[model samples]
Target chain A: MKKIKYILLATIIATIWGCKPEEFGPIVGSEENFLKEMQGTWSLTKVTQVDQNAVSNGWPYKQLDITNIYPYKELVVSFQGDASGKPSTFTITPGNSPKIADLNSGNWSVDNTKAPTVITLTNNGQTSTLTLGSYANLKNGKFYLKREKKVNGKTILVYQYEFTKK
Target chain B: MKKLILSIIFILSATLAFAQVTLSPATFTAEDEVTITLDVTGTPLAGTQDVYIWIFSNSDLPAEIIKKDGLTNGQWTNSADAAKMTKTGTNIFTFKFTGTTLFGQSPAELINFGFLAKTKDGTKQTQDYKPYKFDPLVFVPMQFRVFPSKMDQTDMTTVYFHQDLATDQNLQRMFDVKVNLVFYNDATPVPAVVATRTALVTVKESNILYSYSFIPERLITLTAGTKLTKFTYQFTGSVKDANGANVPVAGPVTEVVYTPFN
Candidate 1:
């Protein structure tokens, strides 16, 4: 009975330690690291607007390019390309401009995890929010962020971007 | 015994987890002049709890009508007279009203309406369904009448125009005005009236028609010396009651003529 109690206690301790939530430390990363992980600009390589029945794929599959401009403090995203095949750039910034034509700024947070990491961005005074996912394959020196999603019935694989560390 | 107890516990847990109130047809649309039906049922406690539905126009917040089903005192009674509380049921309610009744007959008229439910424990809940609005319909034939036949040439013309409120009869006391006047030179249509004025009249107990005129302004600009013959005025206004239904005004197009002195 004593041995059994000891085993149970050991199991409980292991469970608690393993179940502890993962923590993402404060936003810390070098500009080179950010560019390496995020730069090289991505374009919509594939697009599937609707499924077989012409129903919404439940993903924003619209083609848009993401270019990383500026450094850590400010990021700006310029929607340049044409309606179908266009290139855009995203630059980090602290605030919005009065003319509204030049720049757009918002609060952003990033999460680094396994294959699919997340970056949440908010704009319009917290009225709108969007989550972006990034996939990195270090062995191949390739990294990409999801820009759209692939829909199969109820399942979806959001579109991503490919980049090489510079 | 322990196995039996565990089985009972699992069954109870499952039942509690699945218990929920199922509201059917969660969305509604009342075509121009149609009635909307809402059906609700308690998934677990259907008969034990009674549901009360209240309809509010232009409000998405919870509102109480006097209880008329002999439920409570001093509470708003849901009687046959109240236009809002019609056709109450155990798990169903129907709301009916014409487009012109809910929102005045005008273009792009947006009016808000909401629904509420009360449980037996007096727990009241309200719905924030998107507001319902009436798109302006083509011109509906309407008439208006003016009072006092005599026109005083000395004191700039004071025309008293009145129109019989629409059939809905849900007008509040406040109102607005929109007018169009067509004057004629001899027999041809000529614009004469450069500026226009309006007011609300109240008849006192002493048989006096008290005039409370609003700011006189020009609806249309006219050049000086334009001949005068006939005037066509169109007025559009709304009066909301305590329940928010528009109270109708009565009469025909009120017209005033400038009779030239020989």
Candidate 2:
């Protein structure tokens, strides 16, 4: 009976050890935490492009300066208070060309249901996603989303919108 | 020697013919809509004879007018027909060429127009008219509409403007209009994004005032997180010369910064 009790204790210890602490800030790893933190308004200023394979091949991604490409300068976005990246919209006043409306209607979701999690934005029936890393590892004052695209004699503009919380 | 003497006499006659008419405002701006009075009343040319005026850039002069009896430059009229002087009154003729479009050149560029009285068949001819030179005025934005001259607690700074061609030059032809902005907290620019044209001034204009507003959030918060109180901005108007160099119509005009949440 004592041996069985020791075995039980050991099993409990192993199980507790197997579970890890939050990788981010207070109460990390919970999708709920990540979503809640994303609720406020964040201004998107920059978008960059990268070639992952080219990094090893000596060519890396470049940050695109689209400030002058106008029609749209910065995007002010707000997420819902809940874990759902929903009930959110972004405002952008255009500058030069490729005009985008002032308000872009969209729903958002974090796909942590699989490897290489992503946050997808759906607007006007079109969906765009950004790959996610450790949510807790997010640098204060800014957030980043990354993706991979194939170029078949076509252009692949990997947009990385640098955000500042408002 | 006889051929040389004939050539000299013909040249002299052509010079004499050129002196037959008086062109007022010998130098005019191409973009301006101005009236030019041409006095050929003193000349002996017949009323049936036409006075052809050919406008050309400085690059194209010593035209083929006398050589091939055709213009080496463009016509003054924005029409299929050439711009021929008309007898408005007596021997006095008038030639009014509207905006720079007639010369197919941008503002601030020089154009030369010469005149010669002759029929299309070279039947009745006058000497080549001395070249008339003009430098088109560099258009400037008539009035700048920097609204709210102050900012309210909004996410954007709004500006309105309407360029009237009748009162002002076409905004599109003017140089890029930039906004110089500096956000300050306590009368000091905490972080300088100086000489920033944060506001994208498109060439689009209308008789009715149009406007655009952008969030000054970045100009204030871009450097370090500082709560924005106010910002100072100015308007710098300019235009490009014939060589594409900026020619300032007016220096930068400073405007009072806006108050947020006011």
Candidate 3:
């Protein structure tokens, strides 16, 4: 009778643990949380597009004063160059041109396997198999954003951006 | 507990049921044109419906309908000749007055214009569309034009005044008119030691010309000793029209007093 009770208690604990929802770190990098985290303002600090050769080439990038990433049925990225920070919207597409896939709408997920962290973005009809990484330099400040991405076969890095907390 | 929940629900529902509408002026100017428009939309209705427009005098008189040309299926378009108001849509309407003369003088005036929406059953709705309530009072700038009919080398010249009337519409309201004469030497105008009244005439529709005359009262008063080289004057006055619109006029009217002083 003692053994049966112990077994029953162990089974109940295991069942509860299994049923409990998985927590993805403090940020909970789920699709909805990823969107919520990226909804505010973000400056382009570094952009890296990794080519097929696995070699990363950081382009000479000019960061706009501030960039705003907001959800409006689709992912909308806005930036302003002036001190007043008048913003204009831009669309992000994945891959090569002619057949450049739009990564504007749909769901997004983050993969934390790498050092910089990879963001997996998926849109309406297609998905980008490549992952993006945040800059490792600034970990203490609110300037947290995915500044680099693996594109084509190389890594492109964006070094600077103008962003304000919205 | 049920009553409390019911009251809370009623309050929330009432808060959500209220709607807001705003009206604005597209264009406004004293002389050339004035256009007013209303923007109406709310959660209570998806789209706008029938609307009625009316203009009332500030004196609480019965409002009048100033119709425009091109009316079809209840939509009205602005006319070319007269100031008019028209309904363009269930939520949008415009009142425009163009090419109206504003003579200087009189107290500031206000004209009240408004519109209302009606249901399909012809019942008045609850929205206030009075454009005149939000109407901005404008002060027409004064202008004066002075000219002499005759000029002699050494002879004294007299300045006469003319009448004023509303050129666009026939109305019988006149305002106090005043003209100041200043003699200028060379190209620059010289301030007069004393202001002489050129005319004190009332404006009448038949009398389009308000006349005033200025004669040299004494020869010794002339500083140039009848050898007046140049003479120019400015006129200023105020006018109030039948609609209680105040207009002001001010500016210089130039006339040659003499040929030249040797």
**In every candidate, what fraction of the native interface contacts is reproduced?**
0.00, 0.00, 0.00
Candidate number of the best TM-score? 2
Candidate 2, CAPRI quality class derived from DockQ: incorrect
Report the Cα interface RMSD of each model, rounded to 1 decimal. Answer: 32.7, 20.2, 38.3
Instruction: List the pairs of residues colliding in candidate 2.
Output: A24-A136, A48-A160, A70-A96, A71-A94, A71-A95, A71-A96, B30-B136, B151-B258, B153-B261
Per-model C-alpha RMSD: 29.4, 21.4, 32.8
Number of clashing pairs per prediction, in order: 54, 9, 49
Off by over 4 Å in 2: A1-28, A51-56, A60-73, A82-103, A113-116, A133-139, A147-149, A152-157, B1-262
Model 1 root-mean-square deviation = 29.4
Q: State the lDDT at A12 in candidate 2.
A: 99
In terms of docking quality, model 1 is incorrect
Regarding lDDT, does 1 or 2 come out ahead?
Answer: 2
Per-residue lDDT of candidate 2, residues B122-194 (tens digit): 4455445655666433323435544322233233344444444224453444445545555544322132433
Q: What fraction of the true Cα-Cα contacts (under 8 Å, chains A to B) does candidate 3 also have?
A: 0.00
